[model samples]
Target: MASIPTILTTIFLFFLRSTISQQIHSNPDCTGRWIHIRRLPSRFNLDLLTNCSQYPLFDDFCPYLPNHGLGQKTHAKSHSWFRTDPMMLELIFHRRMLEYPCLTPDPNSANAVYLPYYTGIDALRYLYGPDVNSSAEHGLELFDFVKEQDSPNIWARHKGHDHFLVMARPAWDFSQPLINDPPIWGTSFLELPEFYNLTVLTFEARAWPWQEQAVPYPTSFHPPNLSFLESWIHRVARSRRSTLMLFAGGGGVSATPNIRRSIRDECENDTKNGTNGGYVKLCDVVDCSNGICEHDPIRYMRPMMEASFCLQPPGDTPTRRSTFDSILAGCIPVFFEDLSAKTQYTWHLPEEEYGEFSVFIPKEEVVFKGLKILDVLMGIPRDRVMKMRERVLELMPRVIYRRHGSSVDFRSNKKDAFDIAIEGTLQRIKSRLQEVAVL
Candidate 1:
């Protein structure tokens, strides 16, 4: 008979093949042989950390490899360090996780691990220690999970870590034992404090709380300081209206009265014949063909194929849905936010084309700044606006991320804010590990 680990490993490999094999049916781009099997799933899928990659051993089988801690967990028992061999990164990067079979619901795996994935912050904590070094530098068990709990066979570690459960779907329940326990906070809006520790960063600040029951209880619900694609996202050139763009559909309320009024007023006042009226448009709550959520790409792609600028507003304050929607729709986003996007993501929107590709609304001046529809109409000069739209067309191919298996650069570059957040968080973990003598 095989040992428990070996048995588990075998079971994992079986599902891994099934998962990869199923991909040929969905993604047209995944025909070639994959270099390394990425074991993780995307956020739209079930895994906590999507888009990130794992190589060879972890990718080939381990579904529970927390983004940050799996390596450490493996090391704790095997006394073996993860090999940072160049060949490994190349393989992992080539066989994208998005193309795997287990990603879709057509044929779900029955024996797959039932555990949900960890957030990026928890991932950092599980992989790196939660301490800071004098030089702000420290080494972590590279490729370790950030917040891995002890297995059933051993004692659970760090009872203090909390999870912020952001309910993007109403089908989920917060009253349960596993979800209600820890530092989990809950936020219906990306800015609201719903989950315990993690932040649900989004771009739609005004359209939130579709139903009263889903709203956060106890009026003092604090706004969450969640993550974003990067900083500098707020500073970009605006996209043109002639080209088509699309936005995702969700349960959030429609544009508030003030926003609607503002758009109407802009249409009445602007006679210059511009795309101000063209920048944003709303779609039906349910797609005509399917009953899935409005975010489904297959259902939402039509509108995106029609317009150029997708008005990205937050479903909650500070967090906007348009960031992902516009990107996925293959159109440039005209961002409207109370806070600076650059504070969260690093490479999200580029700068050289700042005035020519995207739009940013300052947080402090939002109410005073007026609705994005009107601001977009009156704010941009026709000549400049047209030029920006042209730039968007040029950058569309590089900026848009199609449904595929390869890991995408969520942001623009190495110095991007999201990258900084991840790297900085990793350094903090290293320090904590040293102080606790865990390193």
Candidate 2:
């Protein structure tokens, strides 16, 4: 009894619904293609491991994990694993890429090529050892290898612009000048003109040349699968936060200003006075200088989960691995420097206002003017605090590097840090490719 137009509208609606359902089930985010450069000498990566015992922080750096560094069993009763030397991102990124679905064996079919050079670990071999010349030699060798590559390959295809290197250390570490009055730590690998156009994914990037992208520092929590990740998220969300704010770091020294010391002093002094009518719980500072602050996940994560805010000051560099860990624990980060998060991590953080997930107090206000840390955090409304915490939780997956060989499909809604980074890198390459085509 329905008119022709009514029947046609019903059929059109049904077809549209089916199309949307198909799109929802499709793997769109993991569509980028990449090829790993296997031509580099194995010695660059393998040589470091041959004498792993001599490397600095050997125990922290060289733990043999069963699942391709997913880590060994923390205990027989649970599936939880622990990893150290978050600076080992170069190794992990390379391993994860092999298993990444977007990786293609053929370079001709790829949009971007990855150079899996262990630049950080290799530098550590010489920087920490007695051989300074050996360090410089390593840098020269890598430069020569890339410079010698044939044309029509990934490096020459786009004049090294389409090629990328993932480094575990900050950009300054590799890009240090050869001649300087004060003599900085790092090699001249980044100083080569041949690498000017290449993209470098580093823990912290310098302000200039926009090709240096900042990725999340690796954290201790590598969930075995999606279920474990989901469970932790739920647990942290419901965890009763008893403390107003927490600071877990040693008193800063000469090269590093004593802002951390000042923060610790204020936190301890406030705790003694029973301040904020006993509502504020100021915890003790963890002495990192004593080696007690290394590789203990529970010690670090528990307090972060229980605290409303985690204080982040500049470490040896402006960035700290603890910033990402705080985000993973769903505790909102309070940064003292703009470079800590705002200026550095544009690729991973929200493009909109940062106030949605974090709080920033100028370093001078806290150190020079002697502003109260507890009072500042207490001023934020309870509802706003809840909203910030939620946003931090939402950002957890993007900051975490999931376990390699995990059964979880990255193309699904559960995209991890690796997924996000690859997608972003691919998109950048695609944009560059389009620009080149137009020119």
Candidate 3:
């Protein structure tokens, strides 16, 4: 016969052990189990590789994946140019999930379900092709496909709140237009009531919604392993920056008017005048419309690596891919609008003051108010500039997406953008489930 205190102590130990086991199983670093939805047609994804030449910008997009989608080898020291379309993230995610250790074969055991719909590619195909009506009808096809999958009721279990979506473009591209306004762009898939509870990952997110999360825009540089990343960091640390600021993009649209021309004119004017007691170097300006700007990785990264600040004005949208490229090159980004970085990318960037890693001068100050872009950047103290560059270097790893199926040893404590996204998505799903249970 056991004493009362002894039995109570034994029972407590058993419960503690079970709780610890559950915690370990749910930890993303440990288990990280997720299942991909298998209902989507393989033709939509696999066929793209075979017929890539038929699509737009095939020359710029196809060469990055020379290994039949396994990704190019990175063992060689020679620099590889990898320029891919931003929307190609959907396919990369699908390929990476197939080999991810966290992926579970069984749906019942999965923490969340991933719908690998080629939404961006599919929409673009119809938009650019001869079929105009098909582009608008694309959302209907996806919605009908989901509604038909009620056999085991996996999606119906929690009304798809446990499901997740990954979009390479900004959230505005998928938004539906109001009754009075004309349709701008993108499909109506996101506007469907079925997706209200779903978690969406996009390059840029709207301010109102809690479901839409902002992720880093994909850059041309996708280092295979920790050594490649370390090598690049070491090189950048030793390299001398001879330019004070650089702007490598073109003009903006009517809706999002930018001061790119003003900045360009200032750079040219300063170079002609030889200002600043030679303390500030000449500004490097590249006309993006001349040839392939970002398609050639070397041409894009060279000026960025040699400049102290990279001027990032708004493009067609609020966010620009160059912002990530600048960070990866250890160049502090100078933003003209709050929406460009401050409101967007909250998930990837730090919550501290924006000035810690970037510089912000309102567009009005530079355009309407006629403040000089160079003067503003040169005003920042040299010590503060060094600190900002260090901060940007610290955030470099999180802003990049690793090569698909790259050989990365898990024990090395190296995690790229994909790993951070998975961990964050799993955490968000777990929290949502707990809230539903309490309600």
- RMSD for all candidates, in order, please: 17.4, 12.0, 11.5
Clash count for candidate 2 is 0
> lDDT of all the models against the reference?
0.31, 0.71, 0.69
Arrange candidates by TM-score, highest first: which order?
Answer: 2, 3, 1
Candidate 1: lDDT of 207?
Answer: 29
lDDT score of model 1? 0.31
Please, what is the TM-score per model?
A: 0.38, 0.85, 0.83
Q: How large an RMSD does model 2 have?
A: 12.0
Better of 2 and 3 by TM-score: 2
Counting clashing residue pairs in each candidate, in order, gives: 78, 0, 0
Return the top candidate by lDDT.
2
The sequence of per-residue lDDT tens digits that candidate 2 reaches over residues 1-439 is 2333343354345334433433343234435664445446666764454454575553435453233444444555555456456667876786676655555545665678787777787777656766554433546776667667534455566777677878888988877665543545776667767677777889998998667888998777777688888898999999888777777665464454466866777766764333553444655454566545556766778888888888888877899888988898888899998888888888788757689999988888877887877778888998999999999999998888877657654336687778778877877777877777798
**Model 3 C-alpha lDDT per residue in residues 225-330, reported as the tens digit of each score:** 6777778888877667878888888763234434876786677677533355243466887667644675566776888888889999986687898899899889
Q: Candidate 1 regions off by >4 Å?
A: 1-11, 14-257, 264-300, 328-330, 338-340, 350-356, 362-383, 386-439
Ranking by lDDT: 2, 3, 1
Q: C-alpha displacement of 121 in model 2, angstroms?
A: 1.0
